[model samples]
Target: MRPFLFLGVRPEDAPADDEYDAMLRCTGLDESTLRRVRLEAAPLGVVDLDAWSGIVVGGGPFCVSDPEDDKSAVQRRVEADLSRLLDAVVPADKPFFGACYGIGTLGRHQGGVVDRAHPEPVGAVTVELTAAGRADPVLGVAPPRFGAFVGHKESLSVLPAHAVLLASSPTAPVQAFRVGRHVYATQFHPELDADGLATRVEAYRFDGYFDPTEAADVVAAARTSGVRTVPPVLRAFVERHLHPRTDSGSGRGVLRDEIGAAQG
Candidate 1:
């Protein structure tokens, strides 16, 4: 089976590793099955879309909505790399999952307006599935309302043309959206659990997610939140698309039995 590609933009080792492990846990993919690529350390090379089952863009401190002058050279380079990758990934309708920073990357690429108008503080919040979301094959597994970790300096202020909105929150109306048939992005972190949030809260205390003085309180809030339903979405996504396409067509049909089994 092809490995899943996890593209991480976080430069800090501690936070990056936490995001990696969190994604692995959520996707139920062993380290061997998921490859981590850090866009901060180096620019992305040619990506053979067929080489991976799916692509996941992890959370990062960089915000696309930031003023150009405020962004460092590294951020600019990473943004360019992601844009180049998306140029390939979107048109092919590749299975891609973007969380937090991903929303900005994919949204911007798809001609959506990303801005700081809808920033969410670091913590857990109840996300409600939209009508389309409840009918989605993968996200349908989620309950009507589920807790998810959200911390972002920007959001999709305007969804891309033709994108399907899957989930939303009062604070962030475009919490989750699908660009093409298979590409998905979320403003919240489905990979994040309580412990992982706690770890991030500490590691990124001074990164402007929240006041450094409130780190402990933020961690406490995250530790006690009920977020059991969120990760299953990730697991379902991986399970649904694990198989490569056959000569016939897209391989989504192969997962019907598994999906029905889960639904049953």
Candidate 2:
């Protein structure tokens, strides 16, 4: 079995480690089963797709919708590297999961409109799965509606033609989506628990996710918010598709159905 690759974008030590730890917990993967790489420190070269079972990209401070002049050189390099990676991942239809910043990356690459037209505040928000989402194996067991932690400066204005709308919220209409059956992206943080949300609130308070004064309030709300339905999606990814896929038709049959059933 190959290890799952987790690409993190945050430069801050605490947030980076927190994101990685949370992902590992939700995916039900031990340290040996997962490999984490920080994109903030450097750029990634050619990634051998077969070397890993799947890819997971986490949220970051950067925004794709920001003006070119406002983006630093590091941001440009990271975006370019991710584009190159997606070029490989999308063609193979490999299993890929991306959170907040990951959605922007995948959306921009697939020609979807991503902008700051709908910016959500830092707190728990209601999300409802769509008809297709309800039919999806992994999401079938999820409640029709649930709370999710979201705080972003930009969001997907419209989904790409090839993408399937999975979950949606009043503020962020394209909360979650899928492409090519195996690739998924979400605007909300499925890795967040109450304590994790509070940690991030404090870490990013000065970074514009929310006003410094509201940190206490945000933490309070996050602690009480119910978002237990999201993590199963992460565990499903690990259990359903963690095996090495060498043959072209490897992940297309019973295993695919089993993956969905495993989630339910």
Best by lDDT: 1
lDDT of 2 by residue, 46-140 (tens): 89999988999999899998899999998998999999999999989988999999999999999999998888988888878898776665444
What lDDT does model 2 reach? 0.82
Error of 1 at 174 (Å): 0.7
Q: What is the C-alpha RMSD of each candidate to the true structure, in Å?
A: 4.0, 4.4
Q: Which number leads on TM-score?
A: 1
Give the range where candidate 2 is weakest over 10 consecutive residues by summed lDDT: 247-256
TM-score of each model, in listed order: 0.90, 0.89
lDDT of 1 by residue, 62-157 (tens): 999899999999999999999999999999999999989998999999999999888899888778888888767666667666678899888998
Task: Give me the runs in candidate 2 sitting further than 4 Å from their true place.
Answer: 243-264
Model 1 root mean square deviation, Cα atoms: 4.0
Cα deviation of 74, candidate 2, in Å: 1.2
Off by over 4 Å in 1: 244-264
Error of 1 at 175 (Å): 0.8
